[model samples]
Target: MNRRTLLTAAATGVAAASLPSMAAASPAMTVKDTMNRTALYRSSARTQLAALRWGSTTARGLLEQVLAHQAEVNPGVNALATLDVAGARAAANRADQYLARTGRTLGPLHGLPMTVKDALETAGLRTTCGSPDLADHVPGKDADVIALLRQAGAVIVGKSNVPPLCQDLQTSNPIFGTTSNPFSPAHTAGGSSGGPAAAVATGMSALEVGSDLAGSLRLPAAYCGVYALRTSRGSSPIVPTRGHIPRPPGWLTSSDMLTLGPIARDADDLDLLLDVLAAPAPADRRAWRIDLPEPVSRTLDGQRIGVWADDAYCRVDTSTRDVLEQVTREVRAAGAVLDESSRPVDFAASNILFQKLMYATSAATAPDAVFQGEVKAADAVTEDSPSALYLKSRTMRHRDWAKADEERQKLRAAWDAYFETHDLLITPAAPTAAVPDQSSVPAPERYITVDGVRRSFYDQTSWINLASPVGLPSLVMPAGKTRDGLPLAIQIIGPYLADRSVIAAAKALAKLLPTPPKAPGLMA
Candidate 1:
């Protein structure tokens, strides 16, 4: 799509980004009876279940242990916005009973505990949507995805924290307070999924649900040394039964470009959660029900990867670059083939197209600043005729958004073509390590280094944007820590609806890389 057309088409933006589980005696368990540890501490959701099965432990016991640990540690991390201990336990008990009576498993998540971002409503819980305005608002029914997970036998442990209105990367709200990075207390835990990422990194939960419009999920994963997946737009069920978006008569209900997906310490668990979360909702919820195709790889031999780490618009930070280099080297060392040199193919152009559309997203989200910028920028191009639909959509109009909708389709087509040649694209998750806490992050504030060069913190959303607009899938996994002990990770962007391929690739890379360290005093 042409630059003007793309900008004209967008008047948009998108969502929280992630939450956990327990110790069982069976294969997925790794607990120690002697030390009261069951191979469960800091174990991946996938591995924990494996240890439980191996140890012949009960799922109910594992769920209890996981829940107990989260309650115990959350006092320090401040991750949960609302935890439903009684309800979660009741659900866990039912899952165990079902296993005994029917001898049939609900799904991969049977007895596993998970947390959804507060932006997703869970019936009877406070679905604050990360805003003080709705701090005490409770929902009467679960969100479509929440219902799917409940049916899959996963326990809804709690609701996770997001920045107020999910408008920023720092996860803080007047109602729930702030969530700090387990690595450095002074650094923000990338939001609005910061609470979930921090919880996952600290071994407080097994898997988390977070949304990302412009790096909401990816940034937290990068900042917290965890893995997050942003599925292709609409690929997962997002029934608004509990009303995440309380729209008036003519307003839009949640942005269509963003998606809700799972965050985990392992790729396998991501797939497991995706299965539960992405299924079709019941008949009444069909408008947003999407059919996600099966995973691309049954084996790793033919899996082609296109890797890009930097671009001219925003330079990847030192620690970020360092980790990406290591990821590239490690993937090459493994059986995977590298595309070529360090150049990110057409990243400058990709980012340019992304920025306009992004501003549209922010415009709807933050309203004043985002739309004001668009109006100001639209003024900059003095000679051309622009659509009133675009201007009105940015400012006043709500419906008849068809013109911008067509523009987004063109961009999606371009990205679809790009992904046809590559199974997955690899890049940095964020441009820098965690930013300092308590400092207001001006949208234009760059991640400046000791060398005195300014780089956009908004650029941190570049990699995720590649996947967001076209609704392509992206997976994030921690690579290693920086010299100063900050976290570093990479995003594996996959083709549309190719969510499984991204997770599988992340899993493969994670095995070859160093394991994420347990946060200090957070996970023991």
Candidate 2:
């Protein structure tokens, strides 16, 4: 059968029975009982890979468990935009045969079934960026990151949902609708990578690849109570953005600030994905092999950590602040030196520059008609209106963008100086836990209640915006849960191109913080 036909069969929940089953029926954790399935889903990727190698579980068996979990949870959460069961089964069969025949595994991610955000194109699968215009769009090839995953023996199960054109902070599009928080249905799974985060949170997928531009990857991982890494973004960038949307399919170039990384259930899993996905662009790899720096210290002992708990510009809510305070106190107790007085860069100034540059880059990909509309809209808006800043930035002159780019270089220098003294900087992932589902509200009109006071909906991204503009590696890990049972998270920012160091810091910090919280609805 052709690719489209296979996808159609998979969408209809057809099992690929014609393919070889790959494993003996007597193996542990068959798709027979909930208890065995629970054990399978709760295990980490490393543990699962060991099981795969030891013959305790087959690739096809694990894929069945993942599909069963997805079938149970995805309807309520709406995390996955498309699922290709037939294709996954076929791949799993191939993986099992190779292992059984050669007594050797494929690669680091051998037999791991995972999902990618729909913003990413997958060969032969529908990849709608939550836009009606591209509802039927299916790429003939995979995104660069997806290709890397496939090369590492990962089974691409499906594509996760994203906001339409990935423009909003909430994951909802006219096509896939809204993705609810895995912890609570009333709250949003933060977007444009919300689906990937939620899927990882609920064990629907073992790993997910999500892109970040203006906190798209980290914010959702924070909200969904998972782990995400915004890979190093400098001269030697990690993951390429060749197949991501917003540049539109078939376009070669993506935005400067946009990046792709992994979202998974644990920090170590994030590290595992970094190993598989981190590579230079195809053109650069012929001569360049990017090697990120190692962590400053393996443990928290004698480490200089910076704690920016809350800020006046974008103050976190009381619950979030409490969690931050607790985390800091724990870090200090663990023998790590904490510095609270040193500010890396001014929040207000950096945020302003970020907005100006981000808006300009976002506008670069807009259609001619849409660009003209934004120009007209900029002229009609009042100087002090909430939308004025965005419109002006979107319509800024090239010289103005050049000036902002220069300022960004200076900001990068300031971050480098700060990291010279500090091993890692920890901050609130957002102003609060997952905000209420605001899919129906317009982007500018949405509000988040911080300390019972209404704040701008965009404030959810203020803390997260710090790492993106300066080309730094930032990791978001679940800190704890809110009083009302929502997820609270903290961001770990390291020096530019220090991607491994950032994940290492996260690994150490995780030891001091509380055990990561599990979502209540499905995992409860």
User: What TM-score would every model get versus the actual structure?
Assistant: 0.80, 0.93
Steric overlap count per candidate: 47, 0
**lDDT for each of the candidates?**
0.67, 0.84
The CA lDDT at 133 in model 1 is 78
- Model 1 alpha-carbon miss at residue 437, Å: 2.1
Report the lDDT tens digits of candidate 1 across residue range 271-357. 777776775446645564555666677444556667777765667667777788888788777766567443333566555555445
Tens-place lDDT digits, model 2, residues 1-524: 43234344443442333212423334442343432434565577888787788887778877766776676567788888877777888999999999999998889988988888998989998998989999899899988888888999998888888999888888988776889999889999999999999988988788889999899999999999999999888744579889999789999888888889989888899889899888888888899886767777778778899999999999988888888899889888889899998999999999999988888888877889999999999989999998999999999889988888999999999999998999889999999999899899865678999989998888999999999888899999999887887889999998878788878878877888878778753353
After TM-score superposition, what is the CA distance of residue 96 in candidate 1 from its true location, in Å? 3.1
Q: Which residue pairs clash in candidate 2?
A: none
Query: Which number leads on TM-score?
Result: 2
Candidate 2: regions farther than 4 A off: 1-38, 376-382, 521-524
